[model samples]
Target: MSHAQHAVPRRHSGDTVVVLALGLAAMVVSMMQTLVVPVLGIIQSDLEVTTANVSWVTTATLLSAAVFTPLLGRFGDQHGKKPTLVGVLLVMIAGSVLAATTTSLTWLIVGRVMQGAATAIFPLALSVLREEIKPEKLHGAMALVSGTLAFGSGLALVGAGLLTQGSDPDYHRVFWLAVALAVMALAGVLFAVPASRTKTGGRTDWLGAFTLAMLLVLLLLPISQGHEWGWTSGRTLGAFVGAIVMAVVWVITESRVKEPMVDMRMFAHRPVLFTNLAGLLLGFAMFTQFIGVSYLVQMPEDVAGYGFGASVLAASVVYLLPTTLVSLVGAQFGGVLVRRLGARVTLAAGACFGVLGFTWLSAAHDATASVIGAGMVIGLAISFGYASMPALIVASVPAHQTGIANGINSISRSVGSAVASAVITSLLASKTIPLPDGMPALPQESQFTLSFTIAGAAFVLVVAVALVGLKAAHAPRTPVLRKVTQSGTPQSAEVEADAELV
Candidate 1:
C-alpha cells in the first residue's frame, strides 16, 4: 500500500463533539420530513382538504428535495458547507413557521417545499466531512448521518403520535417542535463548524439548472399523479413525453455547456459509473422495503398480515429498530472491512443482504416475526452499501469535485426512489380484486408479498450489474499516506521508485 493511503490523524475530543452535533442536526431535520404522517388525519379535517390533497404535504417536500438536492450540494461544494447548512436550517425554520399557521392544503404544500431544503443537510454534511475528517472517522460519521435519515424520521412519527394523541390533535405542534430544533441546529453549526476549503470560481450554470428543473418537473408530475390521472390519460402521456424530450435535451446541453450542473464526463470512469448504477438499484430496493414492510405490519391480521393494526407510533418504532441498531454496527465495522476486504466486496456484501432480506420477506408473509426479520435484513444491507458507495465515489473523483460527484450520486438515488414510489404504488393500487367475505379488499399477504418480491428483484438486478460491469480500472494517483507537518493537513504524495515492485 502507498504511504499516502495511510491513516488520518487521531480524532481529538472536539472532533467527536462536532460530529455528534452534525448527527443530531441531521436527525432533527430528517425527523421533520415524516413527522406530519401521524397527524395527517387531523390536518386534513382542520384544513378542509381531502385525504389525497393532504398527502401533498409529504409529496411536496419529497419532490422539492429530489429536484434541489443536487443543486444545494453543488452550492455547498462551491461555497462552504457551513453557510449552506445555515441557509438550509433557515429554510426549514421558515417552513415550520409557515406550516404552523397554515389553514389550507395549498399553503401546507408550500410550507413543505420550504422544509424540503433540509434534506440537503445529509449530503452537505457528508461533503464537508470528506474534507475535514480523517478517513478512519468518515465511516462512522457518515453512518450516523445516513442512519438519521431513517431513525430520526421514524422517531419523529413516534413523537408526533404521542404529542397529538387525544384532545383535538394539535398537529401544528409538530412543526413548532421542528422550528425549535432547526434554530438550535443553526446555532450549533455556526459555532462548531469551520469554513470549507473550496472556493467558488466558475460562472453558475443557469441554463443547465433550468433544463434539469423542467426535466424533473415533467418526470415527477407523471409519477406523482399518474394513478389519480389515469396512466393512459393525455396529461400523463404528455408529461411523460415532455420528460423524455427534456432529459435528452439536458444530456446534449449539459455536455456542451462550459460549467454544467452535472459533470457528465465523470461517468467515463468505470467505478464512478458502477457506483451510480448501484445507487439507482439500491435506492429502488431499499425504499420499497420501508413502504412494503410498514404496510405489512400494520395491515389487519385477518388478511394474513402481522395483524398488529399498529398505530403509527407502534409500527414506526418496531420497523425502525433494525435500521437504527444496524447502522451503528455498520459504521464501526465498515472501516475495518474497507481496510481488509476492499470497498467492492463490502458493497457487494450489502447488496447480497438486501436480496436475502427481501426474498425472505416475499416468502414469509403471515407472521410478525417474519416482518421483523425482513426489516433487520433490509436495514443491515442498506447501511453496508450506503456506507461504501460514498467512500468509493470520493476515492475516485478529484478533491474539488467530491461534493458535485456525490451530489449527482445523491440525485441518482432520489430519482430511483421517485421512480419506484410512482411505479410500485401504481402497480399495487391498480388491481382491487374482490375481498373474501371475511377479508379486506386487498389481502395484506398478497400486497406485501408482491411488494417485497419487486424490491428483491430490484436488488438482485443491481448486484448483477455491479458484479458483471464493475472492475478495477487504472487507479488514481494515491495520496501521501503521511500527515502534513504544516497544520497537519492530509496530502497526496508521488509513488516511490520501487513502489511498483511490491
Candidate 2:
C-alpha cells in the first residue's frame, strides 16, 4: 500500500493511555535535568569537595545530555524509537540506583551521566506520537508532553526541597525518587507504547556523530564553566575556537557522508532555522525566570534589601510551582490555538506575554505579589512557546527525520539555558554589596534590575523573530496541484493523482 493509503487508526481509549504514559515518562526524565539544584550545598559538604568541584553534579548531566541526545535520537531514527527509548530508560534506572547507592563524588557524577541519557526520551517520545497517533490528536498530545517537560523541572525543585528538608539530609534520597519514577516510566512504556513502524534505514553516521558530539562538548563545557574559569581565560577561549573549527570540519564531513547524522541543509530552511532560533531565545527566557526567580526570592531581605528571604522550599512552592502549574493550562490552550489560529500566531502571542512578564519584573520587583504574578505570565509564555515548537518542526520535516530534528531543537534550548545560567551568574556577581564581618556579600538591587531588563529585551527579540522571521519563512506553502474527483470538482486532497489516469 502507498504510504498515504495506510489506514489512520481510529482514536481509542488505549491511545489516551499511551499519551499519559509517555507524558509521565517525559516528565520523569525531565525532572533529572534540574533535580540536583536544591541540594548542591549539601552535596559539597557531604562529599568534602569545593563548590566548584561539586558543581559538576549538574554540569556532568548537562554535558552528557548535550553529547548524547542527538546521537541517540539519530539512532532511534535508524533503529527503532521504542527499543532505544526502553534502553535509555533502563540506563537511567541504573544511573539512579548507582547514585542512590554511592557516596563517592566520582560515582555520583557517573550516575548523573547515565541519567543524562534521558534527554533522548523527549525527542523519541515526539517521534513515537507522530507515528502512532491519529493526525487530529497529534498536536494536543505533543503539547501536553512538551508542557510536562517544563512542569517537571519545577516539580523536581519541589521534590528536591521535600527530600532535603531535615537537618541531617541525604542527597541520595533524591536519586532514589528518580529510581522509582524511572521504573514506573519503564513499565508504562513497555506495556502501553507500541512498537515503532517508522524507521529511516541507514548506516549510523559515526564520523558525523563524533564531530557533532565534540562540537557540543566544547561549546557547552565553556558555557557551563565560563564563570569559574573566567570568561577570558585561555581554556574557555580555546574551547570556543576549537568548537568553531570542529563545526567547520563536521559540516564538510556531513556533506560527503552518504547519510549524515544531522542534515545541515535543514538549518538553511527558513522554517527550521527560525524555529530553532526562537527555541533558543525562549529557552533563555524560560531559564532566566527559573534561575532568576529562584535566586531572587532566596536573597536575604536584610542583606539584599530586595529579596523576600524565602527558603528553597518556600520559593518552589510559593513562587515557581504555581507558575509551572499555570504553564500546563497554557500549554493546553496553546494546543487549541495552534489547531485554530496556527503555530506562528501562538508563538508570537507567547513571546508577547513573555515580554510583558519580564518587563513587569524588571520595573516592579519590590513586592512578592509582583514577582509571583510576573512568573505566572512568563509561565504561560513558556507553555505556549514549548507547545508550538514541535508542531512547527514536525510540519517542516519529513516523518523519517522527525527524531533528529526535534532532538536538534531540544539542544538549541539547552544551549540557550546554559548561556542564560552563565550570563545571569556573571551579571549578579559583577555588582555586589559588601557585608559586615563574616556575612557574604549580596548582589546590588540594580543587578536584578539589569538582569530582568536583559531578559525582557530577549523576549522582545523573540516577538520579532516570531512575527517577522517565522511568519514569512515558515508559513505553509500551497501544493503544486489540485485534486479533482470524478464529478469534476476540485477537492483539497494532500496528494495528486496521475495525469495519465485522469
Candidate 3:
C-alpha cells in the first residue's frame, strides 16, 4: 500500500464527530467573510470611522486571507494539519475578542486581520476529509462539507440582521457570535479530528509562499477595491499590472524552487484548471445573487418605484432565508449527484441551475414569492458548485498536496467574488431611477435585469468548463506530471488511488 492508504485512518465512531466539526468550521469561515456586510453602517457609527476607514474592516479581512491562506495551507502540509487548525482557530478567537471589546477602528481592523487567518481552516478541513473519510463516502462527505459554505454565508447575513434588530443593539454582538461559533468549532476539532496522518515532511518553501502571497494579494486587492479606487485611476490600473507581474514572478519562482510550494502543472491540469474556472464563475454568480438581491429588495418600493421595501432584517430572514434552507438540502442532493453521476455532471447541473435561476430572477422578480423561489434555485446551484469543485481537486491531486491545491481553488472563488462585487457595485451605480425629493437614488430596474443576465452568462461559461474541461477526466489518469520531491520521487501510485476515490 502507498502512503495515501496509510494516511487514511481506519473508520471509527469518531468520524461523525469529525465531520460535524469540519462542517462547523466551514460554516464559521463562510460566516466570518460576510457577517459584517449588513452592519457596516452600524460599525462605522459605533467606531466613529470614515467610510474609507470602515471599508478596511472588510478589506483588511480579505487581504489577510490572501496572506495567510496559502502560507498556512502549505504549513499544514509541512508541519501538521491539526496544529495549524488549532492555531488558526485560536488566533480567530483572539481576533474576535478584540473586535468585540474594542472601540478603536484600528484595533477592530487588526482583529479582523486575525480572524481572517482562519480562512485556512477550509483547506485544512478538506485535507482532513481527504485523509479520514473512506473512499466510498469521500465524495458525499466533501460535497456535504462544501455545502455548508453556502448556508453559512446566508446564515451570517440573517444572524447579523437578527442581532442588530433590537431597539438598542451592539455591533460587538457580531464578533461575539463569531467567538461562540469559533469556540464550538475548536472543540469539535480538538475532540473529533485525528492527528495529521500524513505530512509531506520537508523544508518550508518560504520563497514560493511569499511570492504566491504577493501574487494573490496584488491580484485580489484591485478586484475587491477597484470601485472605490476608480477603475480607471492609476492606483487601480497599477495594482492590476503589479498582479500580472507578480504572477510571472511567482510562477517562475515556483518552477525553480527545490521543493516548490505548489507544482505549477497541478494548476494547469485540465480538471484542476477547469474546476477552478467553474469555481470562479460560481463564486461570481453566488455573490451576484447576494448583492443584487439584497440591494434590490431593500430599496423602498413606495419611494423608489421598485423593490420590496424590505428592511435589513426582512431581507435576511424573509427574502433570503429560504435560500439558506434550500442550500443545505441542495448540498445533500449534490452529494447524491456526485456519487451517482460524477463531479463533472454534477457541476454541469449546477451551472444549468444557475442559468435558470438567474433567468427566473431577472424576468419575473416583481413578486415576493418569485424572488424567494428564484433565490432558492440560485442557492441550490451554489451548493452544487461547492460540493463538486473540491471533489474534482481530490480526484486530481496527491494526498500531500491537498492543502495547497484546495487553498488555490479557494482563492479562485474569492477572486470571482471580488470581481463580482466590483462589477455589481459599478452596475448599480451606473444607472439610477428617478426618486422623489430627499430620497437617495436607487438602482434602475433595468440594471438588476442586466446584472442577472450577465451572471447567467457566467454560468453559461461554467457549463462549457464542466462539459469540455472535465470530459476525458474520467479516463485513466490526471494529465499533469506528479509533483516531484527533493528525493526526485514521483507519486504515481497516489494519483492512481486518487482517481479511484473519485
Using all chains and alpha carbons, the TM-scores for the candidates as numbered come to 0.87, 0.93, 0.94
Evaluation by TM-score, superior candidate among 1 and 2:
2
Mind giving the per-residue lDDT tens digits that candidate 2 earns over 1-502?
1222322343344888898889998998679988999999999999999978998999999888988899999899877889999999999999999999999999999999999999989999998887777666777888999999989998999999999998899988999999999999999999999877655667889999899999999999999999999999999999999999999998999999978899887656677788899889988889989999889999988777779999999999899998899898889998887777777888989989999999999899889999999999999999999888888887766565779989999999999989999999999999998788887778898988888888888888888887888766433322212111232322222111111000
> Candidate 3: what lDDT?
0.84
Candidate 2 Cα lDDT to native: 0.84
lDDT of 1 by residue, 104-210 (tens): 77887898999987877877877766666655566566656665655675677777877887767889888888888788888878887766655444666778877
The residue ranges of model 3 lying beyond 4 angstroms of the native Cα positions read 1-13, 436-438, 475-497, 500-502
Ranking by TM-score: 3, 2, 1
lDDT: worst 10-residue window of model 1: 493-502
Scored by TM-score, the top model is 3
Question: Over all chains combined, what TM-score does candidate 2 have?
Answer: 0.93
Task: Report, for all candidates in order, the number of backbone clashes.
Answer: 8, 0, 0
Cα error, residue 431 of model 3, in Å, equals 1.0
lDDT score at residue 172, model 1, on the 0-100 scale = 86
- At residue 215, candidate 2 shows an lDDT of 95
lDDT of 3 by residue, 1-502 (tens): 2233334334455777788899999899889899999999999887777777798898889888888887888889877799999999999999999999999999999999999898899999999887777666777788778888878888999989989987777889989999999999999899889998777767778999888888888888888778788889999899989989989999999898988888887777777788889888888998899889999899877776789888998998888878877888899888888878788888999889989999999999899999999999888888888888888888877667789989888888887888898899899989898767897778888999999999999999999998887887755243333333323444454445456434
